[model samples]
Target: MNLKFYTFAKNIVKIVLSPAFRVKTIGKENFPKDGGVLICANHIENLDPPIVGITCPRDIHFMAKEEIFHLPVLKDILPRVNAFPVKRGMSDREALRTGLSLLKEGKVLGLFPEGTRSKSGELGEGLAGAGFFALRTEAKIVPCAIIGPYKLFRPLKVIYGNPIDFTEYRAKKISADEATKIIMDEIRALLSAGK
Candidate 1:
């Protein structure tokens, strides 16, 4: 359950499972090594988080939905792997607190800015949660996208985009909804660029 050991285990899972799914990645260098970086990625597969986490050089804590947290074995393992539950459609305050706390601790936090996986493989509008967290915490926002409605043996590519500083937006007192839209637009651009 230790952070290091959990990371090691997750890496092993990625190695063994990824090849079966043919997951590939590009733009890995965009991931920041230190500090509170908010990695806002589009969800493609259940494998998305582990793929990003294992590929990223830093240990990242992800915000998972509450349902996953209640699962017996997953509950035990996910927290160890640095994932905490966010009650969907409910109070996002807990998620914000946990995310900001991790950033304050100089760690990376992973989130799905789109909120849910796109069953159509098309990008969705950004959720205000991701932007609010980044703006309030002053964490750098790293736009990310995963291409491919990944299937067994199908090729997948996870793209990490450049960091977006929210300082100017913060200075302007931009609304979280507006900030999220901007952040997601950046992510959409990166996703398109990769293709």
Candidate 2:
């Protein structure tokens, strides 16, 4: 990942967003200082990624939708900012491989397990992709919740929960769907507490 660009972009985002919205973060101590980590959050608005990225203590490598990468300026800027394209609505093996590779390199990956943004701002069902990654690698899974509406000047909070260890589940050889449920349940709890 481009550390310099990521830092620059993160700083810019903080400056731009801090005044426009009432942003707050909790449970920052839960974030691991080193090693591969998976940050699974609820997809609310398009700005969710940046909000999470700025609040996070570590740099995040986000898996954005493939369509956004084809856009005019974002196409060139996305990768430089540590954002990668992921083909949604299907099993894109290449994208999966890229995510796996990043985890193997001890990078932090930001994923919205619901696949797409919730129009009504409610959390959606978690997909198997995140579970697949968590099961395949020894990455610490951190359940995050981006709470509150996107309205200007509204109080928006991003809460990071404790890291989830899947060693027993992995040893038990649980299905991806089952693992996803466990992850989603933790996210649901965080969202509830945030509210």
Candidate 3:
């Protein structure tokens, strides 16, 4: 599908499907209208990325697993939305390059810091990759969380927290692990507020 049409369709999906899900966002004003940003969210369900992406007014590029790119239908649409493949449990250098390049181009990149969806709906530990990218690119980290149920048409809530200034940490030359913990804590704070 064409990018415009796909985004249009995505908007429709958000309108029709999201109401049933009770999707809501807080601290949305913190998002920069046009610039590089890194949205680091918690992964609870497979539905997380699209749900968050749809609600946002801006186009966001999400890092998807390489296998999804192989699907014929996804091959056409996913890439247009700025999605690229990241080989799980591997270096995935190309994926990192693509993500950073997108940031350099002043686009938003969405990532689940946990790296994968948690079946139990509990918060998972964040990986160092997200921290590394944020540090390297000096991108603003917008901590977010997707809460509520995930069954078909079930009520869901997406909470966006205030964007944290990673620039200081980046400038300090903080380690990726340290950055990851800081980012994860912010995400946890958002989730806690929702409760």
Under the 3 Å rule for N, CA and C atoms, how many clashes does model 1 have?
0
For candidate 1, give the lDDT of residue 138: 69
Tell me which of candidates 1 and 2 scores higher on TM-score: 2
lDDT of 3 by residue, 64-179 (tens): 98888899998887877668889999888898899899888888999998888888888889999888888988577888888878765666777777778886797799998899
Candidate 2's displacement at residue 167, Å, is 0.7
The lDDT of each candidate is 0.83, 0.93, 0.83
Candidate 1 per-residue C-alpha lDDT over 113-181 given as tens digits, one digit per residue, 9 for 90 to 100: 877888888888878898788778868888888888567798778888878978889999989899899
Check candidate 3 and list the clashing pairs: 21-156
The residue pairs found clashing in candidate 1 are none
75-193: candidate 2 lDDT, tens digit per residue = 99899988899898899998999999999999999999999989888888999998999999999999999997888999999999999999999999999999998999999999999
* Model 3 worst lDDT run, 10 consecutive residues: 150-159
Ranking of all candidate structures by their TM-score, best first: 2, 1, 3
After TM-score superposition, the amount by which residue 62's alpha carbon in candidate 1 deviates from its true location, in angstroms, is: 0.7
Task: Give the residue spans of candidate 3 off by over 4 A.
Answer: 152-154
Task: State model 3's lDDT.
Answer: 0.83
- Candidate RMSDs in order: 1.4, 1.0, 1.7
Which structure is stronger by TM-score: 2 or 3?
A: 2
TM-score, predicted candidate 2 vs. hidden true structure:
0.98
Best by TM-score: 2
